[model samples]
Target: MKKIVLAIDSFKGSLTSQEAEQAAAEGILQVYPACEILQIPIADGGEGLLDTLLPYLQGHSISLYAHNPLMELIETCYGIASDGQTAIIEMATISGLPLIPPSKRNPFEATSFGTGELIKDALDKGCRNFIIGLGGSATNDAGLGMLQALGYRFFNKQGEELGLGGKIMKEVASIDTKSIHPALEEAFFTIVCDVINPFCGPKGAAYVYAPQKGADEAMVKELDAGMASLASVIRKTTDRDIAVCPGAGAAGGMAGAFLAFTNCLLKSGIHLVLEMLSFSRRIKNADLIITGEGRIDRQSAMGKVPYGVLTKAQEQDIPVIAIAGSIEEVNYLNQAGFQAVFSITPAPLSLQEAMEPIVARQNIRGLVSQICRVIEINPRVISSSPSHSKFSSFKKR
Candidate 1:
């Protein structure tokens, strides 16, 4: 009716956050041509995080040649703020699983060396404030390869310097941080993560994620053992027991590596993104807030984008609506604080047909338009009560 805020996440394979918000805005405008709509692109610190935060941070993309998961050179890019003091790096762009073909997706052979190279470059460029998104990584080396690129060397019992890949983890008996980049002392890192798996155990990185990165059952066990070995060495080297920390296993134990060797803070992906976006202030006066992702289910109530948006809106007593391509546990979502949950698919269609960008945009727009029509017919439909003062004040305005 008045001011509406759109803070939606990417629809995975269908639409980006910006596209989804644009489609929703179109729908709202269809019913109320003069209504004010604010679009805020959002992500859960995964693939689209750099793009989502670039404009807001006044940053530009910087491209460079870096090693992929297989240690082959590839062109990748990260974001740097205009002031040159802050840099944003998404690990997925440099060493993600998607960069390697499924047949070649070997966690044992993969490396996060490229991610370290990006950080080293940023440090060289005079950046000391870093925001690193650790998601979709292809390696399970516990950040050994990344640390190697940053001048942290790993040596075996025979004083042999080990090379990259997860298989080398077990051979690492000693670490040398003396050659580390001089600029590291001034750097402060913020790691964006969502999972809470520990460094080494059944619920740890190797057991929980290595299989997805192309490790077999035997490889998983070996990788887990390697992580445990590395953790023991890290404890001796850094005097910090980072093995069982929550989220230590995220990005294949990359979070654990940072925790042990760097001045960094780990934050929930959605919460970090929302804080960076000033989400609470943005939605303070919104009459309605719309947020969703590709699917809404049990995970949606976890630290996902919709959950983050709902929390902020609820704090201000603003009504929130969520729309998804598909949804489950509708009753649970309603009980979780979403004023209403909607599925954008107007009719039954094949998954392939429904995922087409054009079709998704149309579905989103159509769904939002109808929702706006309902509100136009009866504003109280969205408001908590007919006598709600916010709606009363909005009508006077």
Candidate 2:
């Protein structure tokens, strides 16, 4: 390998992208010490948004005192691009499922209020270009809780302010936006989203994701109804039916709420991240591209970072390989245009044992070394075939 690019996504719950890149680099260097290696830590927008963009945009992290899903105060941070006008906010930072302990998770009680607070803080910092990542939330409030934090009020028929959470959407008789933040009028928001479900339906936010946030059957139905009602009110306010919009179901319907309440656009999370970093240009001349996540499965083929990277490599006619913790259910990857996929778990270790960063790194290193050793032993192979014909040729016409 003359020039290899590492654009691996974070191995969630185990390795950061940077760490994975380093491990892969070590293994590659073990086999080809003179080869050039480039590391580009990446994310799919849900996780590692700030980490991935911090270097690309020359941004700085700004910490703020904020509230978590349950409304308790916590310290969180967002990113501001070097230009100082663009802010990157990951909704999971404040309203994420991981914020609350698994035992205390309650989608009905969780709120997106802190997400609004994070945006308001960025607005206060004079940021108007907002890239909001929408996923991993522990709320089903249709983002009304977030709106409340941004100074939009929700009043019941009796003029009483309703409590927080998806269940409380039942009492929302009307919305008051007169007190909304003025900055929102001028701000441009690009929501980083991946879900295609509408705001409310059988396949929507509540039914599809709420169970992971601790909701039961009844709560899902209630939250879905509430989301539908919220969408109706948003239509009245903005003349757009965001409830049925693609990705509106993401982040407890925050995608639709942002569109309805502010100047915002929706985009696929991985694509947006790639564009922001000008990944196409970077991958143009790469001899090889390495990328993967914690697992590679059917879902990985659907706009995940690995697939996103694969698309770019295929566009550039660069051979690509993936190093994943688990390679189950990814048999379609060869047809999807990947050269090869290797599991980081070297042996038949248990999930918990294999997922340890050290273990994963060792496995990744060993596998990469072995792959490189094979390449070194057969120089004619690279000249004749790419991944033994699994990948398209990178030869220039």
- TM-score of every model? 0.93, 0.93
lDDT (Cα) of model 1:
0.92
- The digit string of per-residue lDDT tens for model 1 on 1-397 reads 7799999898986898999999999999998888889999998878789998899899999999999999999999999988899999999999998899999999899999999999999999999999999988999999988999999999999999999999999999999888999999899999998888999999999999999999999999999999999999999989989789999999999999999999999999999999889989887778899999999998888778999899988888888899999999999998898889999999999999999999999999999999988887667778664434577555522
Pairs in clash, predicted candidate 1: none
Q: Rate the local accuracy (lDDT) of all candidates.
A: 0.92, 0.84
Error of 2 at 268 (Å): 1.3
RMSD to native for every prediction?
A: 2.3, 3.0
lDDT for position 392 in model 2: 38
Q: Which ten contiguous residues of candidate 1 have the minimum total lDDT?
A: 388-397
Residue 114's lDDT within candidate 2 is 96
- Give me the candidate number with maximum lDDT: 1
lDDT score of residue 14 within candidate 1: 81
